[model samples]
Target: MSDDKPVHTPLEIKLKLSLERQPLPNISYYQRLVGKLIYLTITKPDIAYSVSIASQFMHSPTMEHFNLVKKILRYLKGSVGHGIIMKKNESTQIIGYCDVDWAGNYIDHKSTTGYCTFVGGNLVTWKSKKQAVVARSSAEAEY
Candidate 1:
């Protein structure tokens, strides 16, 4: 970003970088970097998946993992001005969308549910919460 150079990375590369095949390495810097990315998720929804993937290894991160996270930082640097905007003149109706994945967490065997609401054509709020009970099915997960 110093001289208008944009750092480019494909989604597959991010996935590969995040796929850990060995035990975790030092994560002090990784923890700090992931914290910054989590903060950015407030406005950068596109980075959410990547940031979340990178954060999974925060307790033990490798050099490759750390570099991939830096790639995300560079991505943010170039796309700093990009974000979602709720237009004032859009639809006035409020609607919500929700989804749940049944027992998606391998470690806890818990489900995760997510919801987002929009007023008119603008998003007003969103949440991704873990379910309290283990879901027997996808339908049950939503309930």
Candidate 2:
């Protein structure tokens, strides 16, 4: 992917990937690539969701999954300097924001929750994770 065009987004917003898709035979390279991406997410929250989706197929990745990984690499290439920036500040106030998508995952019908916390205008933490149980309503998912 060294010569590949860079992408603005890590993963296509409309992409619907699943484990049951066509599998690529005998390739351990995908696992290694995903492992690196997982580590990259420590400082690159922009690719967190995309990496999470790609990581799910480590046990049995397909050509489609490989393509997604390439897309993420391309994104990284274009955003080599992109990352959280910390600066000196006087305020110590903490603020947080969170949101959820009800039944966002088509395969498991699970909701995904995302939250980010900030301290004095600097991002301190963030996370995105699938809910343990399927929510019956949007309100339930938010709760």
Number of the predicted model whose TM-score against the real structure is largest: 2
Candidate with best lDDT: 2
Candidate 2 versus the native: TM-score? 0.94
lDDT by candidate, in order shown = 0.71, 0.90
Query: Candidate 1, 43: how far from true, in Å?
Result: 1.3
Candidate 1 matches the true fold with a TM-score of: 0.66
Error of 1 at 53 (Å): 4.2
The clash count of every prediction, one per candidate, is 1, 0
Clashing pairs in 2: none
**Model 1 per-residue lDDT at 83:** 81
